[model samples]
Target: FSAGNNENSIEAHIGINGEANLDFLNIPLTIPEMTLPYTTLTTPQVKDFSLWEKTGLKDFLKTTKQSFDLSVKAQYKKNKDEHIIPIPFYAKDFQVLSTPNDIFIPAMGNITYDFSFKSVLITLNTNVGLYNQSDIVAYFLTSSSSVTDALQYKLEGTSSLTRKRGLKLATALSLSNKFMEGNHDSTFSLTKKNMEASVTTSAEVQIPILRMKFKQELNGNTKSKPTVSSSIELMYDLNSTATGTINHKLNLESLTSYFYIESSTKGDIKGSVLSLEYSGTIDSEASTYLNSKSTRSSVKLQGASKVD
Candidate 1:
């Protein structure tokens, strides 16, 4: 993500200056160094990924806006006695001579086209841009039953700002309305230089789901990755209809590995887990012998019944 504002490399600086800047809400944004994730995305960075993850629909659609990205996806399923197949070729921003959506294998089968657009955004970081800016984003989905109608639509919006409000805070407020599920979600995040706190509230019915996270980092030696950290998270899930909390700790060493552990302070299945991940340099001989990179990584995870 923009290389975390490094200053030592001449090439990095040259790369940054040789970029074409775009605008999102007139924020002097740029195309991502990588491919754009989708077309409808707005940049900087709201931490709304978890909200989408909880909805279990994040992985269904993917899009890219650069460098001729393409994907062929197929799904298999069983229905009654007939087997059906649907293959879709996704291409970005290309004016097609013919519609790719209609080129199915078994003509006029049960398979139908589902045309959807992915939400993607890329941005540039400026001292006086993007911060404190708010916007409302809406999506329109077409009906499969009829091409002219709408099956469902969803709207999500966010406003974020970072300032030295006595303690250097980056605050973000986000809200989402998913009419397809009759759900309205609100999330708030406040992060200092070394600490972050977030709360999310969503309701599908009378009992609203609430989640919270609070974290603090010690010895801030990195920008994107923290060296030492501690956190507590509380969650109430609609499925379990119960509440749970976890306390977590992390210790990371650059260019090598990291260790982490967590304990559930409360949950339907109260438990804890400890894990360690190590990467880089497993032996020069192994790297040469295996014809692989000079790096190797390993992970271990174990569960514990208690927190105290």
Candidate 2:
């Protein structure tokens, strides 16, 4: 992570870059054999007996019982074979079969499935940039995987500029500190005045189930935490103060997607020792498209007409 600025414009960047090579050689991986015992009720079988002696319709027909056992097995061979995988459980000739039912036999007893492949190389990168000029706010992200090389993703953001009297400012600031009892403080502040401003960021991500290729038998989880915030404070004179901020976040996953946005502003003017102040906040959050169980939003407004 680094930041620098010159006479042209102010710029700052935060990035995480990594590369990894994974090779698995004859790893002892096994799927324990599972036995499923099931019972089947066959069609009614009629009892042949002396017609007039005694059997009525209820006694004539009787249901037949049958029991069956199903065995599930996998084929894994160890002979100094190495495989590199981009994702977990990724291999060649890997087949997933459903459990057999009475009507359909998915596979015979002890079906053998192969999970073997080549080695995998993975590369990942993520970046977030804060800029004060519109022309210098666009950024590009480059990444690679076992399947593809040199994949580029473009990310763009808005730039802010402020002008007062005859002074113009374009700047980026970052501060991080750790103190007492594992407590940590981290903050990224970008200011663009007298111009339209936006924050641009990009990240390398794998969509939960789709990219991870998680099986129903195995559990997997993915979470993303991206935040964008902007605030402006204007000082017309020492007797007056004003500030405002807007923050938004959009999170998406295989099972759910969430969006949140909040904006608040406050202003105060001092009359000798007394002061008048007003503030309002609009906060909202709700799920979109996928899940609705995690949904809620709130709004708050407060103001003080007179302060002594």
Candidate 3:
């Protein structure tokens, strides 16, 4: 779920005035998925054909049922640097209201560092001069169960070095025993023996190079006739310099295999009614220095019928 690196440098400057400096650097990367059980309320009811013999509502009620699914994924990274300072100190224990019963001494050190990152979320706390001459560092990274738990497995690695020609590399891998289902919502209903169904699928992926996020979705219904629909979307980082915040959204729509359209729109709209729909989009961005991002979204409608 997470990984990190820590390095310490003891610099000795030999000059008119001899000086010693200690510096520490830390970098961590994490991908965590957090998921919560989807909840819904269900009600049982009886239906009679005589009640809606001539109403379309009766036909609609007879054919459809409803269901929902939700999921989320988050990615995170953090870097920290600190200057270390050693202190000479000693501590003695004594009775609160009487003469000292025992005496002890301990050495201590202090450190200061700054941390920051994205996608996976994290919190950090660093303590200087803890338990004699030691520095304490701690962090937590969290992700949506739908994202992290869904991955069958993952592999990660890191490499770093200073002015020296030597390089240090570390790698990690993890696998999940359970399958994480993608985000999906569906409705099913029964009218007599005939059944009707509708479903929607949604998903998101993070692109670190461009510092952006991408998402896509599809929604449609199943009927005796060919009824299909789908959508796509993209998001990007508008401010790559300051907060690294992102702003982007593109969309696409398709009907069967015959027509396709990509656009940004709100509210309700209608597209061709075909047996299938195919839609997709690509979202990417790059900053001037050390910042790049990319993402993609796609949807397809398929059936036994063949279309060239």
Candidate 4:
């Protein structure tokens, strides 16, 4: 006898090879459940031998986990669209031969890297000119064309002698010593409706001194390097003198007078941080002397301030 089950029912049959068979047509089967103790799943006092820890499998897993994260990031970056930025180009003495548009960077994945011309063989010449008035006039051998042209136009239409004299004096000065530093030229006209003659002189002096001094200031803790502070002080002095004669043509005799001005600047430095203090004083005197008749005036001014 043999037993089998199908969709309809379970069956039992008896048969022999190459012989007539008779069969039990219908039978039913039942499956019964078995019970186990919960203690079987509880942790045992004796632990299982760990091949994973002994073979460093945990470290391997950790490393591979990081690799998985990197692989995911790489895939995400690869699937994204490329970004492009325009490069501003400048040229003075060289020319570009070739430019590349795209390259692969590990940090940024596939990025559009623009590498341009780096090396080329070329010869170049540049000109930079520095000139003083003495040199420029010596080169041209005459007044500048612009000044000459303007003077010619003004000379044709002007009738005032003082104006003509002023223009001539300006041309002479420009041709001779316009840019001559610390040069004093004395020439004046006393024949106009309002006649004035003056000599002006100015001088500037600057003295800069750098000083280094050790200052012990605690930054925060005791074991760090001490900060070093540098102090700079600048002293400046300016002197201006004007000697002149004024003729007011209106019942006042020509007066000869002189004016003197002096100014002194001083600076003070303090603190580890950058700081500056400045003080200045100005002294001025005006005096007119003619034939033992003299008038005098004087003024003094001072100021100070600090900056941080």
Q: Report the CA-based lDDT of candidate 3 relative to the real structure.
A: 0.30
- Each prediction's RMSD over C-alphas, in Å, is 28.8, 32.5, 29.0, 41.5
For each candidate in turn, the TM-score is 0.20, 0.19, 0.19, 0.17
TM-score between candidate 2 and the true structure: 0.19
**Candidate 2 global CA lDDT score:** 0.31
Better of 1 and 3 by TM-score: 1
Residue-level lDDT of model 1, residues 1-308, one tens digit each, is 12222221111111211222222223333343343476755555433234334433234323222222122222222223333464456456674444334432422112211222222222211111121112322222232221212332333333333343423332232222232222222232334543433333333322334333333223333345544333333333333433344343343334234333322222233322353222211111111111134434444444434333
Whole-model lDDT, model 1: 0.30
- Tens-digit lDDT string for candidate 2 (75-106): 22222322333333333566554443333222
| Global CA lDDT computed for model 4 | 0.26
Off by over 4 Å in 3: 1-182, 186-208, 222-224, 238-308
lDDT of 4 by residue, 230-258 (tens): 22223222211111111111012232242
Sort every candidate by lDDT, greatest first. 2, 3, 1, 4
Q: Ten residues in a row with the worst lDDT in model 3?
A: 17-26
Provide backbone clash counts, one per model. Answer: 2, 16, 22, 0
Predicted model with the maximum TM-score: 1
**Distance from true position, residue 90, model 1, in Å?**
50
